[model samples]
Target: MILTDIVSRIYVLNLPERKDRKKEIEHALKQIGIHWQANQVICWPAIRPSSNNNFPSVGAYGCFLSHVAALQDACHAEHGWALILEDDAVFASDFNTQLPELAKVLSSEQADLIYLGHCHVASETAAPAGLNISTAAVIGAQGYLVRIAYLATLLPYLEACISRPAGHPLGGRLHYDGALSLFRQFNPSCRTWIAQPSWIEQRFSRSDIQAHWWYDRWPLLRQCAAWARKFKQARRHAATLN
Candidate 1:
């Protein structure tokens, strides 16, 4: 296995709406060889005050971010690797079958990040192809297989600075971008890809983002801003060359 030296621990980060989801995840884990420790699955309530300013708070996104931070820390403290999943995700056949080969691939290439497994192409016809070279295969976080050493640097900052998108009072925000920022901070030259053939099916942004109480928005917004700035610089350079 690519990471035989690293122990695999799985955790679910969840909120009130996710009780059923949590059960589903737990069952899936049990079916595999991983023994569940109660403390491993952490839950935080999503509690944002409504605009009315009188009713009880309700939102899960914020809580999700908080849990992500906690999981990152817990993974580091335990000296083990972590696989983080949302309540809604489901796995497929060969999930276990592919781990050894994937791990071998990671080790052979000296990869810094393992994106876990995800379907690069949603439909049946497409093929996955975002990896940079033999060393690193770019993959999505859908079913992430995070190495603790790589994630320790960003845990402290995750809970703070996340907020709703600009001009959208009731928008959804997340820290994938912020996490990417940390990936760049630690590695400088980060490579990513979708794992391939399989992926988590989440409701895309076709619906308006649901509001959440504890989701950090600022960090993500800042990351977005940075991305825009970089894109603009690239555009300018291209124009100059033209």
Candidate 2:
């Protein structure tokens, strides 16, 4: 199978603090026998926004911007679908094999986003065989796959809104929340198959000082918040199952 026919390229958007993160992830990919160099991957400089920005810009805002910028640059340079990933995410051994299959499914269905793995509503909605999707968040940056056409469509809007939440405690690169809001707004939810085993996340630092405050200062509060959200999502999924 021409892997490029399914989805042309893949990449990672890393943070400035984690300098070694990319090399490690790349090494892992090689270990898994996925030759990323043969596949297209554009590793841009990690984002370290100057303090003078309109907003604090602590989050992956610039990183997300950089991710898209790289996508545009690479696409202009080569031209095709670009799969975006984060530095800390680990892939399954079968990731390369899965890509083309997922791409075929996505194209056949015309889905806006094809989730590799994600949290979901409990209801057992039937997804296409060999793949399914939900309204849940995939540890997205782990390995987000995007359509070239879809990327072109969303790039301008993402560019426009990337700066919206900057400076806030929640701001940073890879605006998953903002992107999710935009996803639901423009495209109705569709099939995004959850990776049978979600990708593993490596330990990484959150550059946002505010993240440290919530996570470090109020550790209990952070745990509570995570538990609560997980609980709600589980409840919803259970209801669907019922």
Candidate 3:
């Protein structure tokens, strides 16, 4: 599949110092026939804590900011849709084939956001082929496609957070992905979904922000617990629907 034909604009978030990670992503893209361009790399800002306890950690804050930067660019760009990817994203072997199909589905449905990859913890069950739209339960901003029209609502909400002083009630409560989930809940027009059998996976790398010993030592157990929580939530949601 021709990537440019599917989505004209693609942005990858990377820190300036992480040239190695940039190179790795570029090489992987080339293997999939995507020509890596320097301009495609969005330089992530330096990590710094807010004066108050708005953000959970400097790294989380920086990660959130990087996503905002990508959204701002998408709002400014001419394309109707844009694909945003993190530098550490590992593409699946069939990414080229699957992504174009996903794009077509999103366009036909006028989807607001579709996660191309996500953590399995709290993951919802996959939708069947040809009908992939569903209310997302967990969202990992590692790789996603966003429609520019949705950014019309999203930008103002983010800008409001930007205007607030640190320690404000809403200042740092939401990470980027969390913000998206909330937006979908409050905005009746907003629609979102996850692509089943994610087309990408996050590469195992030491996080530049917050560090947790348990995540490092017992990753599988942590993921299992997450899934358990998701299943419980799903049951509750189903009961409500009935």
Candidate 4:
């Protein structure tokens, strides 16, 4: 199935300052035989207005709003489906080969949403080429396909999260992806799936959404720190379980 047939519009979350990222995604698309310039992913510009609600940072708030804007555009369009891509997305070699199957699975499962890539997936050797979608370990908003009709059900929950809360018994994060998971949780009818061996991965460049003065300047330091802290805590948790 041709992508154009299923996904009528592709929106790339891009910032004006980040021409380099736009170039990278465009090249990746071309490699996969998608003429990005011809198709022209509507480059959604970055917005950074002040957010009164709590977030990790201003960047995080902007990122959340940006995803919302992309989804809104997708919903408004009469397109069949919408492919929302973060500018940092780099396509994989297998991505092109997998498109037809991906399209098929999405149709067969009637998935309202499917992640092209995310943080992790189960190493299911049994069904390598089959749908490796699982219920957990799939988080992040970098790359995903959204069925046009499902947005109506989704937008309310997302918009609700934006409002100054009245009161909720449970604590939850309000980041875009987190809100997505919450929506899926509250409404089991929202069929969500994930692609195995992710079609896209975050480019190794510094993040526009979550950059830090020190980390962006010296990324290796950030990686090393994460490794050191996370690994130590992981081992500690394992010991407690044992």
Q: Pick the TM-score winner.
A: 4
Candidate 2 or 1, higher TM-score: 2
Q: How many residue pairs clash in each candidate?
A: 19, 13, 0, 0
Candidate 4, residues 138-196: lDDT per residue as tens digits? 56778888888888887767776766352342223356676666677677776777776
Candidate 1: where is the Cα deviation over 4 Å?
1-6, 33-35, 38-60, 78-80, 105-109, 117-140, 156-188, 191-193, 199-242
Candidate 3 versus the native: TM-score? 0.74
The digit string of per-residue lDDT tens for model 3 on 199-223 reads: 6666655455556446545779756
1-242, model 2: which lDDT tens digit per residue?
Answer: 43445566766666656666667667756654545554465555556565424433455445555566766765553434566666655554455656666666656755655555343323445455345555544333455556566665656666655665453333323355346445544555433445444433332333332235455357787667656654764564455346
The 10 consecutive residues of candidate 3 with the worst lDDT sum are 44-53
Reference-based lDDT, each prediction: 0.44, 0.53, 0.66, 0.69
**Error at 220, model 4, angstroms:** 15
**Better model by lDDT, 2 or 3?**
3
Error of 3 at 77 (Å): 1.5
lDDT of 2 at 112: 57
After superposing candidate 3 on the true structure, give the runs of residues whose Cα lies further than 4 Å from its correct spot. 38-53, 121-126, 129-131, 162-172, 212-242
Ranking by TM-score: 4, 3, 2, 1
lDDT of 4 at 9: 81
TM-score of each: 0.54, 0.63, 0.74, 0.78
